[model samples]
Each structure stands twice: as structure tokens, then as C-alpha cells.
Target: MRLEIRMSDLTVPEARDKRNSLASRTDVLDKVGVLATLPGDMHTTTEMVASFYGVDVELVRYHVKANREELDTDGYRVLTRSVFESEFGSLSNLDPRARTIALFPRRAVLRVGMLLRDSSVARRVRDYLLDSEQRIQSMNVEPLTGLEYALRLVDAEKRVLEAQARAEMGEKFKRAIEGGDGLTLREFHKKYFSAITETAFMEHLYSKGYLINQIGKGAVRTEGPKAGTRRDGTQHRHPTYKGKRFFYLHGGGIHGGKRREGTRVRPGHWELELRDQLAAEGLAANENTAGLFVIEGGNSKGLA
Candidate 1:
């Protein structure tokens, strides 16, 4: 005698609901030999998921986009803000400019496995899910106890403290930027965007036309040393007219008892405008922030 499930497609509500019920059963996942997760976090990345199912990353992303509502409801999340850097920053091959990272908890991975139609592994996983629905529902995950439970409690508290630290730092930077004439670009990045070097930020701005090379171009200096040189070639930086609104020419400051001209940015304006600019450049803001500031794009892998 043989028993079989006619439900080849897991997208149907009945099958989908069954998959959800079995999502948390790691013993079943181990029995099926699905992909392993990160060591400590027990989360899997898009690339790893795609590799496991023998499909391109694009296909995995397509499934994600198509079933986002269901997947997100299960456990899918896009990591943005400071939490990403504080948590997964050390992951290998991570692009420094990536402002958003897609993460799938174990349950979410199971959901994806069930939803994927093109992969053979997905087919088998879905079959097993439907075939063992009763068993999976009855399965009980082992509860933590003793030292393991104590360690988990400590880890949970540590995460809470880390979250609070990120919030405090953001608040501190906000207060600092909202004061007086605001911070110089270098100072601004140092206070809020410390992961990005001042040079890299300036170079990106220059390349994006937010800033222009002042020297070696037309417009000779009218005052100070080398006033007659048609091309002063002093490597002075200037914001284009479009980018000028975000900045104000800070009057020369006493440095080593000598004054120097500089520019300062209005952080609030700069932050919003820069996000729009990067969006035009094919970057994106996280959904939580997209409504607040970003103008376009979806999948982001750049400086926020």
C-alpha cells in the first residue's frame, strides 16, 4: 500500500497552512537535510537558500517578491538601520555600502522551501511537509534548561542593551546635527556614518554631482593667494547649485591661528536629499524609512 499527497503546489491555503505548522520543526528539517544556518543566529541568507535549492539567487528573490506577504508574516525581515551593522557586519563578502540585508529565520526558510516550484529539493520538501502533516503538528521542540537557558537569557539581555545603545547613539547624533550651523561633512559622517571614511563619502558625492571640483576648472580666484591664476588647481571642493541648498559656506575658522574656509551641512536636509539622490543611483532605503524619506527603488545594497 502507498500513500501520496496530490497537493504538488504549496501556495494553496491548506498546504501553506500545513507548511507554517511544520516550519518550526527543526528535527524534520535535519531529517530532510536542508541547508544549515548561521552558527549563532540560526538565520540563512538569500544566497545560501538559493544554493541549497539549486536555483539562481534571482529565482529565490522572485519567490520572495511574489510571496512577500506570507513570508514576512512567517519570519522574513530586511535588516537596515544600525542594527544590521551591530549584528551581522562581520559576515563574509558583505558589501560595505549595503544598507539593507535580507534575513530569513528558520521558519521563513521552510516557507520558502515549500513555495519554490522549480527546484527538485523544494518539491521533495513540500511532499514531506504534506505527507507528515500530522506528525509535524504533534512534534514537540525540546525546551531549554539549566545552563543553556541561563545563557539564552543572557544573550537576550545583551541584545536589549545593544538595541538601547543604538537608539542612544542615534539620538545623540540627531541632537548634535540639529545644533547651530550643523556639522562639517567630515564631522557629520564621523558622528553618524563612522563606518564610511570621510574620503569615501566625499568621493561618492563628487562622482554623483552633489559636489564639483573647484580648481583646474573655469572661474579664477578673486582674492587670497594666486588670485590671477586662471586655473588655481588647488583641489578646492564646491557644491553644485543643485547641491548647494544642503550646505552653507562656513566662514573661515581659526586653525593653528590661521583661518580657513569650509562648508557645513544641514543634517536633516542632507540626510533626506542624499537618500533621494542614491535612489536615483539605483540604491534604496529600508521600507520603514522609505515612507519617511526615500523616493524610489526596492532592493537596496548601498550606503543609506
Candidate 2:
């Protein structure tokens, strides 16, 4: 006997509901906000939706274009510059006005999936969706064990402790930046380490260095540096509404974007040539601080 393969309404709305169930069960929906049932917007984009079903982006777009009115409810969006900045503000050295990007939210992707009749990907999407429904039906949520409850308690406590640690560390770092004489980091690095570049001087310090402090992929509310001159000789400025990235080690915010060459020196070499240079400039560091700062004109100072 042959079996007839039919499933319930495997539409985008159904698929989304299915995924939301999966997200709650698995709890990894932090990156994309699909499970978030507020008003309209969800982060499962057109490109992402296409990729999820293994279909060509163009094919998805074609289907959406042919069925615009039907899919107009809770569909696509042209992401504005401000929205894009809010999302990817931590990206380093990017021009905010470079270009506009398109996004397809939950309903839009689902509508396209519903309309796609020919692609194998669309068929797979249907199959998985049905499977997901089945999985949801068959799921057995047993009661949490004593150990599991304890583990959750422990995890919550750990998060609070980590937040406190972060706050304390931020204060220490602020003091370090504003600590010593009014010498800027650029002046300190140039005056001390005479390497081909300031970076090689720093990597040496990371090993023999002080308790190295590093900051990565975060926004600075300060002014972005001047980019270039326009054809009309007018200058363009990065908006204060946007944020720029910075990397820091020790007290200097000048570590990343500097490349190193072959055969960097070891600790023994740091005090000999590097420290000798510092002595001439009336500067000195304990063995902990070796050569950890770079010479870019930042407000941070007090490098050893």
C-alpha cells in the first residue's frame, strides 16, 4: 500500500509559529528577534529566509514581486542609515553613509516561501516545518531535577558577579588612563620604543607586560576622526548619533590596525633597548609594564 503525503497548512505564519516553539524549547533566539511578539518587526530577514530554505535569493525576490499585495502585511523594509548604525555600531572603521541595505522580516520571507512552487528548497522548508510540528507534538517536558534547578541558580548568580566584576574593572581602567603625568600615549611610545612600528613594541609588552587590559568591539561616544575631502572641497563628518570602534591594551587605545613583521623580540630584549630609550625620555616601568602602549594621539596617558 502507498501512503499519501499531505501536511497541515505549512505557510510562513505556521512555520514562524513552529520556529518560535523551537526557540522557547531551545532558548537560542537571542540573535534574531523572531519569537518576540510585540507589534510587527522580526529579524528573520529575506536573505536569511532564502538561505534557510536553500533557495536562490533572486528566486525568492521574484516570487515576492509577483505576489506583492498578498505579502504586503508584515513584509519587507528598506533599512535606514540610523537603524543600520544601531545594529552594527560596533564595526570598526566603517563609513556610515556608504550604502543602504535591504532586509526581509518574518512575514515577507514566509510569503516568499509560500509562493515558491518550483525550488527543491521550498519543498524542504515544507518538510522540515511539518517535522517541526511533529517534534513539538512529541516533545516530553519532564520536570527539572534538583541539580538542574541548582545549576540555574548558579548561572544567575554567576551573571550578577560577572556584571559587578565588569564595573570594577571599568573603574580601574579609567584610573589607569588618567593616572600618571599628562603625557599622551603617542608621545610616550615614540619617546620610548624605537621599533619600526609601535605595534612590535606592544606585542613584546603583552608577554612581559603589566596586567594587560584590552577593550574590543565597542562604541565610543566621542567624535570620529576626519575621513577625507569631498570633490566639492567640502568636508564630511561622522555623525555623533553613530559610534566608532576602538581597541586598547594597557592604557593606550592604539593596538589594533597595526600589523607586525617577522621575528618579534622577546622579554630580555625589551628592557635593554626599549627601557634604555625610556630612561633617556625620563620614563621607566616596573618589570610588569615592559612596552605595552602605542603612540596614537588619544586622550589616554600613563603608560609604563
Candidate 3:
């Protein structure tokens, strides 16, 4: 009773419909592997879905345009106003002014995997689906034992709870970084380099010649009315040229009669460098690393 499935040949209407019907079997996605997504929800942005399929976001948009009706029916949606804010507001990295954000649920992502013709990941997913369908057709309708049924339910419940926990932590980290130009040294250490205390991190910087206590030659003030001038003896520490690559002195405005001068770490470069450093020291697992999760491709343009 196994039917030949050409799920990847999206041009065939019968094939498209066949795959769309199978989209509900999102358990196959679990077999594919856990893709990085925003914590609480099972949705991913177009860019991330593209990354999962190993294709450019532009290619994803192209497929969306060609199959909008089918995709929309499969729970593809463009969120806006309060809905957008409610769903994605926690992602401080997203532009505050973004009026619309498109989200593809697990079903829609599975649909895309079926529709995509050029991606190797998509091809593999389609092959998996076809083989799975054939196997199901070939199997007898045996009733599951009570123990096996309970195990399945437990596994499903565990996945849901784990996803919820990850989502909460992801939102917390994003909130911690909001309203700031970049991460402070303390914040950076807390998030990415927690093995050592802030004091120890400062000492590491000093020992590595990245920071110095005394105002050396070419030292420039980076904050207050004296900013851009030679750094005075008043400042506590300054970053050397090498340190400046990852950390920068920021803020020069006077608030409450105090000249504010703070150091901030560059995000991407800092994370990469810190990860490498920790790995070299055999402490990579201790680093609180959040890999890229839900990156939306810029603006809704053709997607809307």
C-alpha cells in the first residue's frame, strides 16, 4: 500500500498536496534534529528557517511568494502591532520600529522543507518523510502497550517543558542587554565568562596587557567634558590597543554631578574570542553560550 512519494518535486500539484497533508507529522522534525528557535514558542523567523534548510533567506522569500496561499493555510502568518509586540518584543535586537514580523510555525517550516528544491537539508528532510511514510504503510496496526504509550507522552511533555525553560532564559538574557549600547565588562563576564568573578576578569585583562592602571602615552579620555583629550589620572583604568578591539570606553555625559565613563564589550567579536579562549583552557562547557536563534531577515518587503 506504499505510494511513491515525490515530495521534493514541488512543481507537481499532486506532490505538493501530498506533502502538505504530511506537514502535520511534525514529529519528523524532531527526528531531523532540534533547530535553534526562540525559547517559548515553536516559531522561527524566515532567516532562521533558511539557515535550517541551508539556503539563503532570499530563496525562502521566493518560495513564499510562489506558494503564499498554501503556506498561509499551513499557519504562516505576518504579525503586527500589539500581536507583533507581544510575541517578539522581548527580542531587543530587533528594530523597535519594525511594524511587521513574519513567523513560520513548525508545520509551515516542514511545508517549506517539502517545497524547497535546491537545499540539501530540504532534500534530506523530504527523503526522510518519504521513507517514514513507506515504513508506516508497510507496518501492521499493532496496539501500543500502556508502558510504551506512557513513555511517548513523557517524552513529549519533557520536550515542551525544556522548550519553555529555554525560552524564558533567552528572554531574560535579551532583557539584560536591552537599552545598552553593548555589554558591560561585568555583564559580559556574567553571561559568557562566569567561571571567574569581575575582579578576576579585570586582573586577567591587566595580566594580558589589555588594560593598565597608569595613564600611558597616547591615552585619550573617552568620557566627560574632557573626553577626546588626554586621559587624566582620575580615570581608574584604560584599555590598550589590543583590548580596544573587543572592549570600548563609552558614555561622556554628566549625570547627577558625576561624569559617566563605562566600558562595553563588542558583542559578536567578544563572544567569539571568549569562546575560543575558554575552549583553549578546557572550560568551554562552563561558558553560557547562546547560539544564534531567531534572526529575522530584514523588513517584510516581498514577504508581506
Q: Candidate 1 has what TM-score?
A: 0.40
**Where in model 3 is the C-alpha error above 4 Å?**
1-11, 81-83, 90-99, 140-304
Per-prediction TM-score, please? 0.40, 0.29, 0.46
Which pairs of residues collide in model 1? none
Q: What is the lDDT of candidate 1?
A: 0.64
lDDT (CA) per prediction:
0.64, 0.44, 0.67
The 10-residue segment with the lowest total lDDT in model 2: 237-246
Top of the candidates by TM-score: 3
Model 2 C-alpha lDDT per residue in residues 84-135, reported as the tens digit of each score: 6576443333344546545565555544544566656555555555566688
User: Candidate 1, residues 32-140: lDDT per residue as tens digits?
Assistant: 6646444233677787788778889899998899888878877789887367658743544456777777888877777888878788787777767766775766889
Which parts of model 1 are misplaced by more than 4 Å?
A: 1-8, 12-14, 134-304
Whole-model lDDT for model 3 versus the true structure? 0.67
Q: For candidate 1, give the lDDT of residue 12.
A: 57
